[model samples]
Target: MKASWRARLAGPGYVILNGIRVINIITFLDIIAASVVMLVKISLTSGFFFFEAVTHAVTAGVSIFLLISELPWLCSYFDRDWPLLGHNSGFITLGIAMFMLGAGVLGNLNRKDMGQDHLGMTFWQIVLSAGVLALVMSTINFVSSFVFADGEKGVTARQIRIYGAVAGQKGEIPRTGSHRTFRLSMKREDTLPIYSPQAGRKSPTDRNSTRFPLKIEKISSPPPNDAASSRYSRDESGIAPPDLAHHPALKGEYI
Candidate 1:
């Protein structure tokens, strides 16, 4: 009886352990991250510095890890849905190239054109406009997540998993993580399915059927705001300012 009970217990133990491994240490860090972000959201809303000052060390670390894991996914989904916005590498490359070209070449070229040196209208007006456009495009890239994943993609979220069949013939079973097998006696002409990591994902909106994103986490961000400032900012009356002491120049600007 004890041996049988131990056998039963082993299965459950394996499942739990698998979940822990998949989430990795991110589970613990994700909690801290989500909490810090929630704090930022609430901090913006209440206009009261809960921790006196933003714990840059903690929050920054959280943001960095979360961004490392999730931002690529978000950005990829965005660029996939909207090609004009471009992906991370595309955006980064363009920015870097444009900076070098304008700063190095345009700067020198403008030196003699109208009798100026190492400076040009390419400053913020034109280049910054491109920068702003790039920013807007990147935002467009990020925004695509809201339309599909949030409150919609029911089937895709539940049924969609990266899956494969046994890769080889019935005579040989896979030699990798957690191999489960079942055999059934049948007619002499029965064929068994082979499974392997799919050549690609099968998700409908995946553009080309991608199975996994760079990362997956429950989506959470303060919703879109056209006002440019968060809810925690002050009003025209300048009554309750959000970190006014920190943002002195825009004391009334954001308000």
Candidate 2:
């Protein structure tokens, strides 16, 4: 049977792997192209190159870092037991890469020779456009990394609590069926009331109240009822009361 889109596409893990591969390919190509262009520009002109050098350096650094990030996926595919780098490192690296790209592009644009008068209009336009494209792509990758990483391999920003991953450290992913046990222990201080009566303090009693007049208020009796008084009163014979004689609850003969 043919696999459905769900099976083929799988989840963010596959997507991230494919994305990293694409990024590596693009970076590789960009490095080659930029190197050739830088060489040509250098050979053609003898002017001092400050911005160009910095731009290339930043691009090279970002590209290398991105390329190295593929190691985790590769290790997993090979069924190796390598300590997985926390997935949050992906977005953080992408953000840093984007910032570097933007800074490099802006610095490069500051050069006086960047205009059509010095470099051809076509070449200058291509440089500016490529920089913009790179920035947009980097931004998209960064955002997607953040969004897709939710609950993935249990390596989220909130779960990890770290901005980036540490190399050579063992990173464990929480299992789906794993249970977390939380214990609640009630100590004497916690189980007991916050306030307790002082030692040697006498409880409210008739003797104490008569002498010291305790602040406790006596419970008042219910109001007098003529019917209740007559119903419960017995005659001189001390037999049963006439009112309770026919009562359903007291109809049975007394012992």
Candidate 3:
């Protein structure tokens, strides 16, 4: 077979791509490291917050980028449809896994508010906050193997494994295919419930409830046609004579 100028003169194919791979791997790994440590420190002692959970998820993503970074060489072991980038990929995956595992362990150490004051703390509050951080960080570490692992060592990056199982030819094709159907049929099923324990539950004082035992009396109303002044008992101001402004003698009488 005649080798192309790029293949022969360019040294191994891996040399050409290794620069990008190294940078991506290191950048991703450092982010994962920082996230893991942050996740752990909080999960064990304090706990996760809004963005911290997102960062933990990002850590898991790094492993995937690491795997993709190594595709230059793992493909040569057998007759493969695509070449596998060899040892570099596996080494990167292993390194990521080891770090994640360590982070998970560090996160696990401070479970149950082991470091905080016993007073002024609620049981579920600690569990809810701390456990989530631990869980997210631990999940990132565990899933790192699946997301970024390359199975072999000492394989050059150029060995190429496009199908992933190229040496075995068992990997399935990724569908960049129709997402239109998915989009049309997509259903959003929120796992969280819309209702809470207090929802629709009423207290005794609430007017809507019949369970209130407070005494209530129905008072009789006065007839509309009758003058209030002539009805029943009256106040001092009522049933009184009209107040005359002044008294004057009649026209026929002396002043």
Model 2, 1-255: lDDT tens per residue? 222322333343454546654764464355435433443453225455665565566576655555555434454432243233334344555555655665555455566655556656766665565466566666765665555343434444322222223211235534331343122233333333332233333433323333343334443555678766766675556677566557777765643
User: What are the per-residue Cα lDDT tens digits for candidate 1 across 139-221?
Assistant: 43233222211122121110111111111112322223113233333322234322335434333334333324333333455
Q: Write the per-residue lDDT of candidate 3 for residues 1-255, one digit (tens) a residue.
A: 222332342233334234534544543454455445445545433353656566565655645544443444333442243222233232333444435534543453354432444312443334334334434443443443233332322222223223232322333222232354465456322222232243554433352344333335423553465566455554556675544434454344654
Reference-based lDDT, each prediction: 0.33, 0.48, 0.40
Q: Give candidate 2 regions above 4 Å deviation.
A: 1-13, 16-24, 35-39, 42-55, 68-88, 156-171, 174-255
lDDT of 1: 0.33
Q: Estimate each model's TM-score.
A: 0.18, 0.43, 0.23
Residue pairs with backbone overlap in model 2: none
**Cα-based RMSD of the predictions, in order?**
38.2, 18.9, 24.3
